[model samples]
Target: MRTVHPTVRLAVVELRETSGPAGDSVGASTSTRGVKSTQPSRPTQRPTATQSPMDQFMPKSMSVPKQGQIDSALAKMIAIDFQTFSIVEDRGFRNYSNSLNSMYTIPSRKTLSKSLIPQLYESTQASVRERVQKATAVCLTTDCWTSRVTTSYMSVTCHFIEDFSMSSCLLDCFEFSDIHTSENLAEELLRVAREWQVDGKVVCCVSDNAANITKAMNIFKWTHYPCLAHKINLIVRDALKGMKPTVDKVKAAVEYFHRSTVGAEKLKFTQRQMGKPELRHKQDCTTRWISTFYMWKWFLESKDAIISTLAIVNAPVDALTQEEWGVEERGVQSPGTF
Candidate 1:
């Protein structure tokens, strides 16, 4: 037998021929043959792990802070950041929170006002009680004030030594609707001290020199001291009566600058030209004697700018005479003025 080549024996051959019937009616045919192809089977594939459809959009529940921690932080935002309860209801703030986390929801304003705030207040009260109970001796400072709406309120604060470090805490601030008398004020103080468990441990009480407070302290029978700052204020007020004319001029100047926009701008411009800080005149508050000192001090510091501004603008108030300016300078320079 003739030996056929191995390559030729394995190779598959295909041939094709086309025959046309006639030019008007043509027909064609074709055929193909090939050996079957054998490709190595691919290794079997293991199944893949998959997340659920909801998992793609949902944040990890475990990653969110606990409800208690969120409430506490919200409480701090109200107390420390001075945010109002209605802040929780703001659309912009809610959108911002949603952008940060979809899993956690902000507490409603009603919930914050009714639940979280009160809860935080109770927790803080408990902490204050614990600290106050451990003190050997505590000094109390209390005061009463009336709001612009004529609402009366009282506040108490405690000071003590803890671990050789000075510590202080505000015990309470509550509305005192009753008449402010010695008996009523004493009762309020006693109530706060007893509630905090510091009644017997209080060494002294310090308060302003108002008549009602003074008499209340007397009735409380703890060693009572009038606030030294109040006494100094009294001294300063009495000492300034002799210099009314000079004080009046300075006060008028401050009032003029505060009321007139043109004068103020001119003053600032003059200060800049003089290479001085643009310090504005301070107005004195009748209740605060220190404000008077600040006013006098600022007046002297900006005397040159004030003179220039007054000359430029038709000042409504009388300008200070050179002699009066000298007196103001001397008074401010003297250690006793402040």
Candidate 2:
């Protein structure tokens, strides 16, 4: 055997080391050549310090808010819009914060209602006054209604043409005390108008044709327009008064199923068996005559399913009587005939 030259032996050893375990000649040549190597160098990692008990469970990156930032954000949340305490206390809301979790603090409902709401109301009231001052003419609408607790409330709305488009805003809603007579209503309406400085700008006032409301408008001496919708509603209501017996029977049937869970479930089952889409009966409102039309229409549409459901629930009394059924059939056939 001939002895290898020292230079040749050195080149061979260099090539073997560059070839890597896969022994690719191209990689070996690219690395061994005088050209700079294109391959990346292995990263040198330093040993990390041992984590503490808390760090082990904590997120890799955590955001810690400064005390001032947190307080400012909390105040904005309360003042920006009306939100309930239960919303902030919701399980999903609490779990959404990764940084503070149990440490995150939110104000209670009492704190918001007594402090934040009043502060916000003052600021909003000033803003509304500013907008109202810029309007050339404003139309006023007022309505009074009693709540579930029998507390009376009067709502006032302002409408004006802004940028050639009609825009409206609710000026205020306040509890009305004492008897709701025309004199009392007129006093309140004029007070609200004067407070907003819109009394002089008021060109028209619209309201339902309640005797008290019309009388109030006369006392205020404002141009009054009876609400056209209310007139139409009155006509419809008067016409339907004769059909009350039939309407009442249908309403009772619907109320029976709606108020009882077992009856509702039986209705759903009956609807499925009849291959009908599940529909809940609509209830008529004392003020809204259109609701009565919807109630009757829905009853007629789902008459078969409703009768079947009554049978399934063993509620014979709740089912419509023969005369009542005939009335519904005729009403459904000629909805306009009524």
Candidate 3:
């Protein structure tokens, strides 16, 4: 009927013997003395601790082993700060320091003799393909050069499209082989375009107005836009030829002034004078943003007096021409423009 522990059964015996026959204690053995009773079979159970924190949770037979070298706790610290991963031990996490100087110190190179390569073939292939497809449209730009290590490099530039209107503009760089001719650049461009998932969405290819690039684009269906800003710069360079001497003198004087501390102070003084409109007294030839775009941008109002004060500063006025001409355009003297 009911189960009892050994110590509990012994306590029950003591209580039963002291009790009167009129049910003072609750025990079947003393109350039913007329019937012969048989002892119940004991269950085979491992001994359990009477008092322990883990006593209720752990099985009696389960062993408690020593903690190993790589338990869970130490791994958490490394995960929190990835810089703890040593490149020597894990080659994938290499150290790269930014060095800047005329003569820089060489970084220590680790010889990767062995490494546990991850199974990323499927992942890598998917990533490579997705980069192309998600990009929608792409523009290709390429530049060729030879590196210091004598390696021929041709860098391909790709600009992607995406935005709020699903219109996004993003350009990235990838280097290729320079040995590949314009023909080769053509093939690689096509391949990379496909990789960018730009099979049909490539609206344009933008680059310098080079004949080879144009020729390559001629084969493609997409339009090619030349860098108009680069072309304009080229045009300006050619336009400067007629006034080369004036330009040269102007350049030399600017360099000289930039190098001279006295000249810089004079320029600063002029900038301060020109900064305010009231100091000039007239608007006709007073300096503004356009008059001093680069050098005296945001010049102070007091700079007008400084420029006049430094009137005899070494500005070679006669460099533009050898003729005995007046050193003035209408009435204003020309600064050393060459």
Candidate 4:
């Protein structure tokens, strides 16, 4: 008929022997015992319906930001317009947020691309149009290129003086499905100019020396400037045609070194033996004349090391001969610099 505390029922007890009182000292009795308790236990407190699970772990001095602040931050990220998946999946971005606060949540790729980007783009487009409309004169440059999928696209860029300073912006880039004739290209350019409301303000158009593009500008009656970079590339390409045999020998040697790990290691060892920095041979790019210049420059700088490396590796006869090496060295060091 004894009552026990709720906590006591959950605890363990031990049985021990106790000596009998005065009459029979030899007889012993057994009794159940537990540690004496002084105060009643209290139940652990838990979060209420109103409190979030994260609130328990956060410092009391810190509070969650208002919804508006979060939206503003999301809008800024959208303005940057990085790849959608990178915002959600990049390790560096996730680590950066963790350093700020664990309670902050990042928007998913779908929300960023579908909702936020369109909103930001519209706002920015309005502002750009306002500024562009006030400009005195705008120059335009157009280019057409075909993608890997064989889809042709035309890009039009605008340059103008805004508040006494030069400003450049991309007006539009659209697919061109019509025939790539001069007349068709001229029409497309005029259409873009009208859409941007800069048709009358446009004084000049710049383009590469493609015959079709040149003819297009003539038809449009707009002053045209041929791209200077393209002209320089043409000059270099024509000048280097005479040195093709020597250039080809150098290119073959570079390809041999790159494709053969053993040959590359030999080159590195030769560089170290001669107190020179380890250098990799560069392959010339078909489109970029500067890449060709660099390829020759690197070969010129590393010629002795390359020759010794080739000897050590016992490279095939296709490797650059002594006369071919001299030819390349002289050709790259000529006055016609890229």
Candidate 5:
């Protein structure tokens, strides 16, 4: 009965059959140096727990214990964690109607600057701090417009890093600017970065093709990405100008049919034909472009109404209609542009 460590036995056995001069000397030394050796051995490697079969399954379907038993078990355990929120009131000569900010048209910036950001930052956890630290590399964006005060206001958008699974950047909301200048915007952005301890980390700046933002990016030596989506949308509208008459005609018909009693009646009949009472107004009619797309879907749902209105409305069945309307067509042309 040999009382050998598994690793030691494996090592000795591997060295034994090498059949080289080096192997012979190593085997001889290893064999002689049994339990009390003055030599270094390789570090032991532990079996990974994550490789276990149990880790592969989550007990998502496990049944809960009886409510009474659960209640009793919870009662047996004790816990203590408490948090408090505070409200600051004003003792002033202004209107004390509701809160400190309600009375004045221009609230005290000092109050928020002194109290809010630090409090907000302090309330967050270590993981949030790490995210904030890494997210110091910011991308800035700006758009200028006249406000109700008749003052030109430039809205600043900053992209910050997020504690995310797949997403690297999260778009932070605007910080208002009274003076829209490259120098001013850069100063403000740097202030925000310094506040978050990310001033030196700004790698990119993003904005529409505005001179002010472009100038700021140039001054700061930051890489710039002009809002490609906005540029594409501008190009799309320019292209749409060529088809405006067709678009206007379709829009006029669609709006008139949906907005009026006669049109609503036609839509009701169309939904009835499709057996979809739920799509009265297309529940997700949130975007104008999507609305344009859905009008055809709604019309397809009420193909009878379409025939009743326009006999020439049998637009060739697209691939979308094949799956949606169950109308498979030969030599189908898909509505790929939209």
Candidate 6:
């Protein structure tokens, strides 16, 4: 008896089972066997009723914008103009922008405050730092003052020469709630200097002759120069103390004209009649000594018109005598000499 091979026996059994004992002819089994498919078979799937035909071709969602040019420009404008962030929320502004370009949208104020503005500031600061690092030496000017709301603040500015051209930039302007003692001021200066990596390159500092500032410079161990304008102001203020009576009388005269509408109108009419332009008298500020010179100068320039107006209005204040006029003229020349 001839023995059957195991592979042939297994193939025959599979063919018999598929055909259910009444198997197809030998030629049909030979055509289907010994051939392998080149492509792999994958299970087919049907779309559900809720699925869209175009779903496979479309993206899930749009990407959010990072810092763009328009956003940067808007941030720069707000900073340069000192506008509040809420200005972006104004209906009129929004309407104007929408009319110009409906497709473009303005960023919300929260985004500007939290992201774009800070990003712009950081980029600008980096640019400034790069320039400052290239400099060999730098000078700084610092000042401290209280705002109208009584908040104290300090500002520092840096100046340097690069390629024979003068360049300057503001280093810092921050709220300073600490008491302005010499130690506190010195610590702040060192902190800023180190932050910009310019601590070793600072050659000198210029500030007013306030006791705390002068002491701070000593503690900071940098060369210090007092502002010349401030020095002159101190000198002028000291010299004028002897002439307080005369200055007070002139100030009172300016106040009278300013307070009375009739007196002011009369002064303008007098100026017109005298072939002079209408120049209002300037009041002097106690802090700025130069304003004192301007006050005296205007008083002398409009002296004739003032005399005529005062005579007509029956002014309550004492009129400046000829000696006082000479004294005022000399006072105007005094500040000019410095």
Which lDDT tens digits does candidate 4 get at residues 1-338?
A: 12653222222333443333564333333335655444433333333333325644444432446544664576676466654545666788878976876556666777767776677778788888888788879999999988889999999999999777889888889999888899999999999889889999989999988999899989868999999988887888888888887778777788888799999988898899999999878987766788887888898899889878887778883667678667766767784643
Q: Give a tens-digit lDDT track for model 3, residues 1-338.
A: 12543223121211113333674432434227675456432333334334434543443331222122221222333433543324335433322211222122222222111111122234444655566477656666665555678676555565665453433323334566455556776776787666556658777877766677677777765688887765764564564467555434434444545566776566656656667333321111111212322322212233344335346575433332333122223112323331
The local distance difference test score of model 2 is: 0.76
Name the regions of candidate 4 deviating beyond 4 angstroms. Answer: 1-81, 90-92, 101-103, 146-152, 175-179, 255-266, 308-317
lDDT of 6: 0.83
RMSD of each: 14.2, 11.9, 15.9, 12.5, 21.8, 16.7
lDDT, each prediction = 0.82, 0.76, 0.45, 0.77, 0.48, 0.83
Report the lDDT tens digits of candidate 2 across residue range 168-257: 878889999769899999999998899999999999999999999898888868999999989988988898889887777877877787
Candidate 1 residue runs with Cα over 4 Å from true position: 1-54, 58-65, 148-150, 177-179, 259-266, 269-277, 308-316
Tens digits of lDDT, candidate 5, 17-113? 2333554323333546475554644433334333324533432332334433432322222111221111122444224523433322322335433
Better of 4 and 5 by TM-score: 4
The candidate that wins on TM-score is: 1
Task: Report the alpha-carbon TM-score of model 6 versus the true structure.
Answer: 0.68
Kindly indicate the candidate among 3 and 5 with the higher lDDT.
5
Segments of candidate 5 deviating more than 4 angstroms: 1-122, 125-130, 134-191, 210-212, 257-262, 273-333
Worst 10 residues of 4 by lDDT: 5-14
TM-score of each: 0.74, 0.70, 0.38, 0.69, 0.41, 0.68
Task: Tell me the TM-score of model 1.
Answer: 0.74
Query: What TM-score should be assigned to candidate 4?
Result: 0.69
What local lDDT score does residue 300 receive in model 1, on the 0 to 100 scale?
92
Off by over 4 Å in 6: 1-67, 95-102, 255-276, 304-318, 330-338
- Structure candidate 6, residue pairs in collision: none
Q: Give lDDT: candidate 3, residue 225.
A: 88
Worst 10 residues of 5 by lDDT: 78-87
